[model samples]
Target: MNHGPDDLSSTGEFDSDELALRRMLQQAVQEMEPRDGTLDHLRKAVPARRARKRQAVVGMAAAALFFGTAIPAVVHVSSTGTSANTSNAGHASQTQGGAGQGKEEEGGESTSGGSAGKPEDKGKGESKDADKGKSAGASTGASSGTDPSTSTAASAAVCTAVQLGTPTATTAVPDASGTVYGTFHITNGSTAACTVSGPGIVTPAAQGAADASKISALRHVSGDVASAGLPDPSQEVAQLLLQPGSSYDVKFAWVPTETCPTSEPSTDPSPDPTTSPDASSSEGSSTGGDTGTSTQLLTEDGTTDGSVLVTNTAEGGGPSVSTTVSNACAGVVYWTGLLTSS
Candidate 1:
């Protein structure tokens, strides 16, 4: 009702000269400051999500170490499972007697028959002290590459020469390229001479021509022996020392990888892939490191029950494979780093 400022601009809107010229343009604005490096370029680009969670905890610790402890160390190519002179701290024998030395006598094992590969097999509760052990060359002779008589269709036979807790002497390896040449066996259970080596030979890697795992030692034998005796006439093990008596046959030999998946059923390929390069052991992992592979067991002989296995063969073309053993130790000083698949 007081309409004065130029008659209130003819009733349009108030503008006391444009409200004092917008308060002099908000007092001449000016206040910026915020550009040091923009937080150092996001802290140097953040290392791509902490490098993919440290490569997935190292690819699940290398996929549980080849599906867990190298399939119990390949289950048995004497495959490197455990008990090769596992060492109870007793350690005494090997005085220097060639054929079972002092003639033997210690404390446990003896009475085979069990785990021929599963005939619903029962027998494995005794081997700790089965009546003081002894026996060898139970005789059928042949087993250099295995052919007792040659009649394997399978229900048994991955390896069976059960005596239980002593056998394992012969030491003399050199192949897989180290080229030591001929004769390789160990652990010949002795209580007074030739102590306990229990296991020997290692050649557990093959399949080359550019893959490059290629290892060699052979003679691994150690099936968690609930028993392992027998080995005299110089082969050793008359209980030079390996308490609980003796029952051992932790033998060693393997050959399967000409692409070796073999459709999972074999009678005899018997070490001739061109000349037995056998004893395979490829086993790898590295997720964030970026490389991964899996396989743990491969055999060619066990000789009874069902003859231990898991296989598939095909390569160059590629598409047949197998190796899986989850876990099997049983308990105390037993070893079965065994193998048999030809």
Candidate 2:
């Protein structure tokens, strides 16, 4: 039989036996189809994944058959694949629904794999899946959650802190105001302290000084001056020493009072021709300082010694003063007056 290409068979087309088998298969398929509420339940429970795949396979099979490209073996496989895909989709949907709604309503329920693992492990997996959008099965180890990343960051921070130590403090201060800050580590053998004050080890910044209080403050900041004399705060000194092992600190900050300025010098001679009674005084002979020339002086003993008088006997009775002719030499500091307006 020499037929057209589309109609030609290998002289062994569908025999009676083959045709009967096909008819039986078609009847069985029709009988096995979902009935009553079964089709509705399956549609509600089936997921889009396998259902969509089933539809694709069936469409491909229909197109191939219409074009007369049917191969019996290929058709059998295609139909089987569609049925398996639809069944798997229904099962997947049911699992998803049970995990959530406990019941499949109009739409199928979703699942994060309930029966797939232990309840505890499944819960953790679901949580990770929700956060990362990854497969629940991927959440098996500690690295599954974002917490691992945070933990790594925290560890890095702690290591950095341990290596870098503490931050330094800085501040600016004026002449009268100053910032105080320092740090030192203590060890068993290191008991002595290197004392300092006002920025130097033993010296302090210079400022105006008044009474003992200000001086004491300076000493406190200056870390005690070095000296060999008595350690009396009452005495005046430039520097002092400190005891070992113990630290001392101090500061010298104060403003001084202003003194009057000296005027022009006079042309008058000192020790001028005063009382011609310069010969000698009768013991207790009504004697007193010539108020016109001599000036008053307070002594160390806090008493006024009229014997050691001074006079401003300048040429024009202007700015200068001089002491009397007694105790001229001996290492004593005598005070001379300079003329000042009252």
- lDDT (10s digit) by residue, model 2, range 71-99: 77678899999999988876665554565
Alpha-carbon local distance difference test for all models? 0.30, 0.32
Badly placed stretches (over 4 Å) of model 2 are: 1-70, 95-342
> How do the residues 1-342 of candidate 1 rate in per-residue lDDT, one tens digit apiece?
565445656676866777566556645643545689977777776776688889999999999876877666577636343455443221222222112232322322221233122211222324323422322222212122222122213222122122122232232242342211112222212232112222322223232121223222232233311213312223433122222232223332222122223235557655556653433211122223343333233345421111112222111121222222111111111123321211
Every model's TM-score: 0.15, 0.15
Stretches off by above 4 angstroms in model 1 are 1-183, 186-192, 205-210, 213-250, 260-342
State which candidate has the highest lDDT.
Answer: 2
